[model samples]
Target: MGTGYEPLEVLKPVADDIWIVDGPEIRFYGMPFSTRMTVVRLSGGGLWIHSPIKLSLALKARIAALGQVKALIAPSVIHYAYLTDWKHAFPEAEAWIAPGVERRAERHGIPLEFDHYLAGANPDWAADFDWLVVRGSKTVAEAVFHHRASRTLILTDLIENFEKDKKPWWMWPILRATGIAAPNGSMPRDMRMTFRGNEDLLREDIERMIDWDPKRVIVAHGRWFEDNGAAELKRAFGWLLDG
Candidate 1:
């Protein structure tokens, strides 16, 4: 039997105004998987959190120092593990979720009371952000959000970030075989799966994202991309429209 490799225990800041905290001392069949979290402080007193993992007292204190957390947002149901804890920590703030995530939460036995999510419906919340519901894909009902001021595209599981050279031995095969891992961690497979039968709809969403001209792309499973982020996105998702 093989002794599984240990989980990564480092948190690195990969972009301006962004920090990625990898999981510590954990693994799946010797493959190390890390969770990514992003903290975006919007104009004025608005704060948007994307896929927050566990919030220890120390982590909570670190976050509080940034500013008041105006809203806690989760991109999908699977990413809500720390929502309750963070909501308890920041009870004054509102909770936001993606489409069909609430039902999935209930099924997964996770307690969640989200104030809003894109459920084949429109959002009537804050005005500093715009959200897109990638429709026609029945694989998953979730919405992706873009922040205007920061020009940041917040995503979870929509992209992968494994560095081709740095990936742990076990992960390389799985990621490459799945076509979701690239030299820069591309989600070819998942992106393909995400679009499924709704290729045109996915294209429209990408065009919408292009309109925003975001400066950065944040993914929950991989490194955050900056510096010609739009180009990175074009290269990453190019496989979809091109093929």
Candidate 2:
């Protein structure tokens, strides 16, 4: 909870109906970490919020003008920090849980509740998006989504694009050690190392995503890949591509 950082930014549209915000800062790993949220207006005129950040009074008002906030998602156990706030604001929005998160969230005292689990797309959003499970990491498992209407792929922690300058000075050394600094941001070394024997399963999923040939890719942190997303995605997870 950083009160000293910049104001919450106005939501700006990136693709046809996709808008992204470099959102509120949350304290993580003993320091503040920046956050990002993606909002997509589905075919039925309903809003699908991914990796939701805190809903402030102004943000809530702006979001109301968008459409009904019909779907709420916690893409991974690590991304659930603000789901409770959003769900509290839009009670009618259906909360969807990612696989392996129900138990993880509970253990962490998150008490996440879900109307549906994301093993596959739900009927409400299936028409608008396709999904796959990044089923390798013992520490971080997440669901990756492809927003078909805008040709944008949304990922949580599987890929991080944290810029070095934007981070605090203390994080610089850690960022270098973790290999998630700007310019060449890709799948974190910690995450990649965990894939170990499950390389084929993760590679198969990344291959399907590459096939989508997304026009842009929105990772949870740092600068998103606005173009050449397919190639970047293939390159980011390059470690898994090999046998």
Candidate 3:
């Protein structure tokens, strides 16, 4: 099935040297969730892919036209489903994963070979991106990124803005309760619970993202913010930022 942002597997430019590809929806907990991937062409002419979706020959060709695929990012434990396919296609690309992903992949019986664990500074793409691991969550840790050139903040699941019209009627209440409904979506409640005692840490990270002054915010699942990204960050994290 198509995620409203159709023409799947095709590159849709978000800014200079940056593109987002909407992918097919995946079932999670019996609910269908949309997926997206971001592609960035670094200054040195190499492509950096984040939260990759299902790979296709057409998609691969399109991406190759942009630049060589240098890095494949699994930004969160739950977002690495298609990494293996991409890895097979681009044998030379480095697979950089977030914390806990290795264990999660192994548990799911998905054999994945990762080249680097995302943490601290990496000279490879540091010149074009600023990133940080969102700490304090007991369940999951996400590596958030900000593309320096386009001022675009790339997020996996930190904040979801699923549009009501795009989802089934049965998911309306669930989405509202989870606080992920579009135009007002924030961090999901269950994920927020994981940061109970260490909200301060999450708050600090949010502040740092706001400091980036991103012009647009690209989320993996939902309608992303195209403008006033700093304000959107504050609004999305209002639960913690307010307190």
TM-score of 2: 0.92
RMSD of each: 4.0, 2.3, 1.0
lDDT, residue 120, model 1: 52
The lDDT per prediction is: 0.66, 0.80, 0.91
Evaluate residue 205 in candidate 2 and report its C-alpha lDDT on the 0 to 100 scale: 82
Off by over 4 Å in 1: 1-31, 119-126, 164-166, 188-191
Worst 10 residues of 2 by lDDT: 1-10
Deviating ranges (above 4 Å) for candidate 2? 1-9
The numbered model that scores best in TM-score is 3
What would the C-alpha RMSD of candidate 3 be, to one decimal place? 1.0
TM-score of each: 0.82, 0.92, 0.97
In candidate 3, what are the lDDT values of residues 44-139, reduced to their tens digit? 878999999988889989887877899999999989988989988888899999999999998989988778888764858878888999999998
Return the candidate ranking by lDDT, descending: 3, 2, 1
How far in Å is the alpha carbon of 41 misplaced in model 3? Answer: 0.4
